[model samples]
Target: MPERKPPRAAPLVLDVNSGYDELNLGRLALISGQKTVPPGLRRWQKTILTPDGRPVVITCTVPDDQVVPHGLDNDFMVGLVNLCFEAGLPDGPFTVSAYGLLKASGFPDSAQYYRALEESIVRLNKANYTIDEGWFMHGPHSWTTQSFAQVNYLSYVRSRSGVRGTSVITVQLAPPIMESLRAGYIKPLDLNFYRSLSQPLVRAVYRQLDALHFDESTADGLVRELSAPLMAWGSRLGILSDRPDNVARTLKPAHDELRARGYVAEVELTGRGRDKLLRYVFGPPPVGEYPELALLLSARGVKSGVAVRLSTVFPERIEEAARRFDHYLKISSRPVANPGGLLVAMVQRPEDFAELPGYAAADARPGPPPAETPAKGTGKGRSARQRPAAQDELDALEAREEAKLAALQGQALVDWVLKQLTLLGTMKHFTLPERSQLAELVLHGQLDGRTVVREATRAIAGGAPAVLAVVEDVRRHLQVTHP
Candidate 1:
């Protein structure tokens, strides 16, 4: 056999499900940042005010068998969530190799990290959470009460050989969490930037801060500043100390690191003693320093040096190609195995993609065209005589905007179904002709996509050829109903 190639490096973006972010925000999960848990602290309660100003309480219970998860556990959770996304966010139990998890999470494959990973998994499996109110349900865009364990069940094996460690880990994420994630309640995190931080405390703080800063509804107007009382902020972070001075001292290192890294423009502590309030101005490192092309390229796992070189050498061409690449990344059902290579190819031969559906001149252009300049003699931009004419134009504009939005939503649904099929291993079974036929059926609503995917996964798990079985079953159903 010829020499085998190494596995491709997965993208470093983590679509951090909002439910996890809320849990972290409310202090219901990812316990105190200290290296060691405080003795005899099995239970804790924290209350945070909702955006509407109503206060909600969160009660956390740590079982006697496991210690509260903290520090490195935060990194482990990030890794685990990325694994779930990589597996197409399975509806049931999914298995991941231990080595894959570590590398994805930026952990070294050593006995020390392995032991830490094992310990973190045990703690997560045993912890329980109850939120009396303010559990944001992403599916319905509403807040409600909930109680859950982060992990329903977990099983793993330990491998003695360090290099060839192929230990598998199986986990079932709780329904509430998975439902929210599937419902599109997630924000992208720069896992690469996150791993670059020096301290665990800093990483934890950055994740929490990022969750607060990113607003899905209004992408452009991100929350740029945050202020909280010193004591309360410390408590929210699960800092071990209660004293103000000690808390500030413990946090100083993290604050300094964040400032140096450009995640924070400034960190200020105002007032004195118990009255002090901490304030931070959010400053993402890439904001002013890197050009848009460089930022976009690096965010997708391209090396900084290459991204900078391409952006600087061919500013306009690279930007256009990058946007085209991004459109595919969003709409393609399968993850891009080699994003950099594909992007370079597109940049090299932009004309090859001219006929591609996603590379349309109008669609590739960011945002809608600027509104027509106001007609003369009308303060509101149209005279009384021109009302009908201008009204017709306005209606046309609105119709075009709505059409664009509907097309995007339709593409999103198709992508979702295709992703599910890929996860079930059904897509790989189809020949090119069958694949095209199935795609047509899926697009035309002839296929119950979710049910098919679910059943296909079950069939494959039971050692059956799921694709062939599904086809035969469909044929039988059609004959029974039509005959």
Candidate 2:
């Protein structure tokens, strides 16, 4: 058989300080544009044995700096010896060369230093830190010019003799994965959006109560207390009526159902009613109104009639009641005002009226006879109390309802605007060219175009879009064969 060329010498592995420079050398050599590796040097290929006796191939460039001078500095010689030893050829017939001066400096023979260096090299190679620095001259003149010269060290040894092949496995945890691993998960609420909707609703209700001659402080207090549950109820039922009359009409059934179900009792114009009204005017309520309220009120039963009476006797109590009732009417007028003055009567104690002695008996007496007014001819000094302008009252009520509707429409528009801005913001993070292509695709109905447009319009109208963009995107991107 023809003599097979002795398996090419194993490629050199160099350990160097300047990783960037070494990497640049390899890159420049490939392009053949610059002399990163010194002149006269060329790449070579070789094979080594795996631990399991399989052959592994490697390729590397040979550099001039590997030749150590005969009498190099002890430290430099030690380093070279260590490098060769690490290549699995510690006891050499291994060639050593260096730049002119280093070769002239005497080599050191410190067994301890040599041993420690060898151990370190073994550890470094095991850690996969071996790197090659292209060859260059190794002399004081060369060092000053290039700072540090590169050296390539190759080894040839019996099969299965040294460190073998290694495979690295990497696992990357994406943001969602990391977040899922956390102890507790929560989505942050947009408080600014919450407040923007809430503040106006509260203020509008307060103004309405003020128009009805209710005390401001009392109206504010009542509105604040009921706002939360009311909004929750509205959200649940998806009730977004603009006019108070329509709101009342829409919610009356829900209120009646809750009352009939015994989840809520005495659906009076009290705290519970006020809260429901506030939520209706502002935002969507909770999923199921009765169940949620039942959970809240189960622990605390309704206030006693006696307690209600005592509270009403105080002028402050009457003012508070008026304020609460007015606010409810402004937002939703389902719980009508107490027409028979029952709330006022409940506040008065028998003893307080006893001071008047005959007051109770007089109140119990038969109704008073009708009073006679002066005829046109009599011309009495006093005139009858003028009736209110029905037209004017109706106009005022209509204006108030229109304002509320406008606010709802405005909020819907704002929400749509925010959604559009979010989509644009997402697109901005893409690479320039990619973003341009995506924009074009959006225009051509190939991206999130229709879906985004639909969502935007739905947000503004508080209604579903006529065209479903997500469905359209699915049809375009993932063609499906219909049965």
Candidate 3:
């Protein structure tokens, strides 16, 4: 009789506290749709700083669904794994907590839990996913730290059948290891030294795959045959080793490992394996596929560009409509417009109010003030005595107006900040100079701060047309200072 497979392990609940609530769950919610988040997963309000020092919130949650046989089915599990890698967690040791009602739901083997966890880690790590922290537990006495630590640190996890499982695994994205892999793959290719060939290889492979005349019946044969030539192409590009034997040996282990993990099978590529290979051989999917913009627009109930365009046209005297539009573009996965061309056009013929909706013709005739009657017994001399007192009142009113103007300037600064947050949801990669300039633009009622303005100008111009909208906004705000 065939050996019976052990049952799956119960779902392990994970709670990540990255020091920011937005970074925690809001960011996740932005990336993964709210539907994927387990029902009853409470998002606690909190704040944490990104590597770049921008403040954000952490998303907190508790598992609500029954543990699935395969951990991959759990959205939270996958999200956390992706987050860890994206946050560069593997560079150093870090600690996170996992708590939930643990019961043997599927796998009877107590060791299955460890196996599943380890497999997840390894799969992520081998895919160049970054994680550096060791797994630890401070729970009941039934769970021993020493045993868990030992099992967790192992490079691979073994299932009950003694076959190494690929559910979880962890590996360091150290420079030397990456260099070795690149050298081994690229050395045979006679191309000049270049750091990355994975992308070119992937594009070539994709084109090759697309051109093949194989049906499902012959797809397997095509894949096998094509792998050799593709490998040769990679070798010629200096992405593979010059030594044919060394290249074969190096690639064999990866093929075998992927095969064992069910990422790749004997005859056809599994969906999961295909995705992994695409990322590994290419890179992360393009920004056009980023989920945050989709989520924001969906949640804010924006069905089309009408609302956005209206907001851009009329910012309600608070935020600059153009700037807000630019913010939307920056946070959006959409490509940005070219700055040089836009600037040239803007300088050549500035946009007129006639082009904008809701712009009415200015009235040419002035209206007279209402007529005032003199009080009884009032004369020129008496009016002169009253002149000083009247002047004092007028002076006081002028002072008050000045104060209000200053206050409005302060508020504009604050509004600018809020507008930025609305655009760029907390991500860790913005530069310090950029942040400082953003803050200044809010407070000073100006975007023409020489260095800062130049930076903002570059940012707005480098990408989509939406950025131009933002540049226009900044220009309008700066007008207040100039006029």
Candidate 3 to truth, TM: 0.19
TM-score, each model? 0.57, 0.13, 0.19
User: Which is the leading candidate under lDDT?
Assistant: 1
For residues 390-474, what per-residue lDDT tens digits would candidate 3 score against the true structure?
Answer: 8999899888865653444342333323222223221112233233334445455454323333344456445655455555555
Q: Once model 2 is optimally superposed onto the true structure by TM-score, how far is the C-alpha of residue 53 displaced, in angstroms? A: 83
Considering lDDT, where higher is better, how would the candidates rank from best to worst?
A: 1, 3, 2
> What is the C-alpha lDDT profile of model 1 across 135-252, one tens digit per residue?
7774454777878777777866554543212444667777777665554345446676788888778887888777666442332325668788888778766787779999999889
Candidate 3 deviation (Cα RMSD):
26.2
In order, candidate lDDTs are 0.62, 0.28, 0.29
lDDT of candidate 2 over 1-483, digit per residue (tens): 001112112222223221101111211111111112243434333332221223333333323433111111112322332333222321112222121112111223244433333332222122111122222222343211111122222221111332111100001112221221121111111122222222222212222221121111341212222222343333222234434445555555544543453323434332544344432221221112123322222122212222222232132233333333334345553654542233233222232323432222333444663464766666542233222365578789888855653343221322222223223222222233332233334334354543554444454444333233432433444333211
Better of 1 and 3 by TM-score: 1
Q: Report the C-alpha displacement of residue 113, candidate 1, in angstroms.
A: 0.5
Candidate 1 Cα misplacement greater than 4 A, ranges: 1-29, 139-141, 159-164, 216-219, 284-422, 425-483
Q: Backbone clashes per model, in order?
A: 0, 28, 49
